[model samples]
Target: MKELRYLNKYFKKYWFKLLIGIIITIIARVFSLVLPPYVNKSIRAVEGYVASGSGDLSAVKGELLEYILIILGAALLSGFFTFLMRQTIINVSRYIEYDLKNEIYDHYQRLNLGFYKQNRTGDLMNRISEDVNQVRLYCGPAIMYSIQTLTLFFCLVPIMFIKAPTLALYTLLPLPILSVLIYRISRVIHKRSTIVQQFLSTLSTFTQESFSGISVIKAYGLEPKTNANLQTLAIEGKDKSMDLARVNAWFSPLMILLIGISNIFVIYIGGKQYIDGQIESMGIIAEFIIYVNMLTWPVAVVGWLTSIVQRAEASQKRINEFLHVQPEIKNEIDKDTPIAGRIEFKNVTFTYPDTNITALRNISFTVKEGETVAFIGRIGSGKSTILDLVARLYDINSGELLIDGMPIKKLNLKNLRGAIGAVPQDAFLFSDTISNNIRFGKENASMEEIVTMAKKAVVHENITGFTKGYDTVLGERGITLSGGQKQRVSIARALLKDPQIYLFDDCLSAVDTETEEEILNNLKQASKNKTTLIVSHRVSSAKNADKIIVLEDGQILQEGTHDQLVGREGYYKELYQHQLSEN
Candidate 1:
């Protein structure tokens, strides 16, 4: 219930609709209450006529027909209001469900990369889908049913007591005992429902991962192993669900047994009262029977409502865990600040949050506006980390990081990121058409612009060779294309952005030297008058840059023009010599 308090705002949001629904619910119950009394009158009319022993069948028939018509009219009106009650209240719940899912999705977009590294994709999906759905049940069906039950009890109970106090008292005796049993059973249900929800998340996670990595599983010939593992998880999930079902099974029969006892008390006690003339007529006994049975469904539904609420509370708790987390990175400035791409890092140090590995140490560099600087290094040499820092993906542990002479954090994050076109080391493409994938970098880009950028990245030929050309849809992560083709497509995507700062992180690693040289030439032209940082291992990739920095073990080792470094006897000259020999 404490967790469920979070939904108060939504309830407040749709308060008017809920109020109308409540009014309608009460009115419907009142009309439904008309049936039992009218039934009593119809029975009494027959009894009085029989006692009179008069020759007047037409009078009795007319009176009986009037009562029957009134009963039918009340039933029709009650049914109509009940329908409106659901339309008003249940629709509000759906509206809340829509709002909640959007809220969760927006929060997901704001969360930092570190949060994703610590969480599983399947669990995230489950929270938005399964968990949110559970909460919806609480918002709609559980709430609606609870209201219906309460209204029925309040309206029906008093009438029974006023008609025959002794009989009503005995008939309601089982209710208190039913309540105590529900409380005890509900505790067990809450515990079991939590366990079932958790197992569902685990199962969803396992299934999602298996499908996403199906290629890896097949390639490694581990299909049997994967199948066996999934079977194990499925078995565990089934056992947990059954545990919950077994407890729920108790609710229906328990309700029936208790309500049946109330019915028996009605028969035995109401008969005695009628025989002793304490009751007016057999109609009172008949009315009491109808009222007691009316209570049966609502009382029976209590267990279901409790189960829904318990499941919802568990799901909301999971949603709140992520909702409460503040993003690791936030923009200090809200206003849009234009970027000129003068990136500077002074004594910057950075550590990866998830792994606790220091990726950069006292790294220092500057790329003035419109300068093309290339960073060449061995693997894990902090080349990519420099690019990440400039993009403000992670703040440094110690030192100044500036973009356009402003502290990186002081610039609006959206404006700063928008001004940069970054092609990461591992080129990732969504499961979409090639044209749409390129258009992702610039949403409103024209078809001609996409083809132009694709040509510049040296992937145009491969794309046109396909049957659908740019219209060809790709598989997951662009697995449909070759590695070189994927990298070229990613390059085309960045080029389409046409940003002030271009960061190409070893994007040509898979291409042959001939194609690499051609792409480099095209990039050199496309990136004119823009600050560019190319992080690559190949000498040919960096040789034409205005300035080249050699990095080793999280620190810069050399900074010079390609000719200057090639003339000297260090890593650059050795690499140039080695590559020159291979060529």
Candidate 2:
């Protein structure tokens, strides 16, 4: 019922079309019902004309012609109505699917990063693709077929009773039995189909993970192992599908049994009536047979609709769950206010959802405008967490973070994000031309500006060396580029944004020393009038910063200029010495 209600939102928007389609279907069914009786009446009239020895041919021919015309008219009406009904259903289904897909996509964009982190890309794809498709199936043929079945049954059953009450009652003896069988089989089908869908989601997830991580698998020589795992998932998916098929196989035979029993009962009773003269003609028996045969579709639809409903229910639940998950970071109250990039953390703390321990505890720092600040720490030292907090990726658990003297909780998220530019460690790239990827940061940026930024990041020469230059299509995640090239492209993207506050989180780690130096020189020149924060492992990366803060276990242990930190003989000094020794 909940699933049906959920589907009704889309249906209601097209309800008028659906209602007209259903009305047309009812008209078609009515025309269909009139056919058997017309044939029966015409046959009886023909019999009477033959029985009477003095029957005039001209008088009988007119009646015969009238019957033929009525039959033709009914057939034509049924055909036209059926066509309109089908067209309406198709239009409604297509429109509903369009709206649903757009809604899901828009919802996804509004979701926070944490929601994406917990969800598998393949599972999300299945919800958008497979699950929505199931819903569409229900919306289109399943809905149309269901309406047609009920309308046919209602129109035929009452007519059956009026024609021969006793015979109609006797003929329907197998219906209850059929209903029980259908109910049981439907339950089994629903259970198995749910399992099948879940297994399919798992299979999709495995395939997506394998393809996305193919390079890593090859690098580690784990292809055979990965292949074995995928084969196992495929086998499991196959088994579930077969099991659902096995359940569905029982449905057709049961329908056949019930339909056959109904036919046999109708023949026995109608034959006796004909012999005893209670029924007047063979045409009446023929008509009854046709009417009984019509019952076949409604009964068969019962089984088929059961499967559609089950699949749609499962899909609805999955989509609803995704839509219901609350974002970890909610938008702030002041949604349009701008900030000047003066950031301060006042005893801010945070813990990830479903975790006991804090990732950042009582962390505090401040960066004034036009200052180049550096955060140095070992792995798992919450350096990245600081950057994430500043970017509003996660909300603080206690205390406050302020930008330009306004609480970050009160600053507009879009404005805050728009004012900051970040180059992350992983250096993610889209499967697009180099120029387009850089333009992602600033959509309306000209080609000339993109080239300038690329040159500043030391990637312009490399990009121009390709056959297509800036138009060269990169592979997924820039797989065609070297690590350093990918890193420089990411830097170029950030630099192109020309935001007020720039964040480089270990952005120079993958490049050679000389290239890193050149990039740093460019960054220094570019960031002279803007506030920049760099998180780096190498001392050289932070050596020229106006202020360097050494973070250990989410707490700032020391803060000073490069010369002071190097001379202080603390964590920063030790890190500097270690890097110099390695070089």
What TM-score, computed on C-alpha atoms, does each candidate reach? 0.97, 0.93
Model 2: per-residue Cα lDDT over 30-73, one tens digit each: 88787899889888888888899779888788888898899899
Model 2 regions more than 4 Å off = 53-66, 354-357
Provide the overall lDDT of each model, using Cα atoms, as 2-decimal numbers: 0.92, 0.86
Write down the TM-score for model 1: 0.97
Residue 249 of model 2 has an lDDT of 81
Model 1 per-residue lDDT at 233 = 94
lDDT of 1 by residue, 409-503 (tens): 99999999999999987899999999999999999999999999999999999999999999999998898999999999999999999999999
| Model 1 stretches with alpha carbons more than 4 Å out | none
Error of 1 at 343 (Å): 0.1
Residue 377 Cα positional deviation in candidate 1, in Å, after optimal superposition: 1.3
Least well predicted 10-residue stretch by lDDT in candidate 2? 326-335
Residue 470, candidate 1: Cα error in Å is 2.7
The candidate that achieves the highest lDDT relative to the unseen native structure: 1
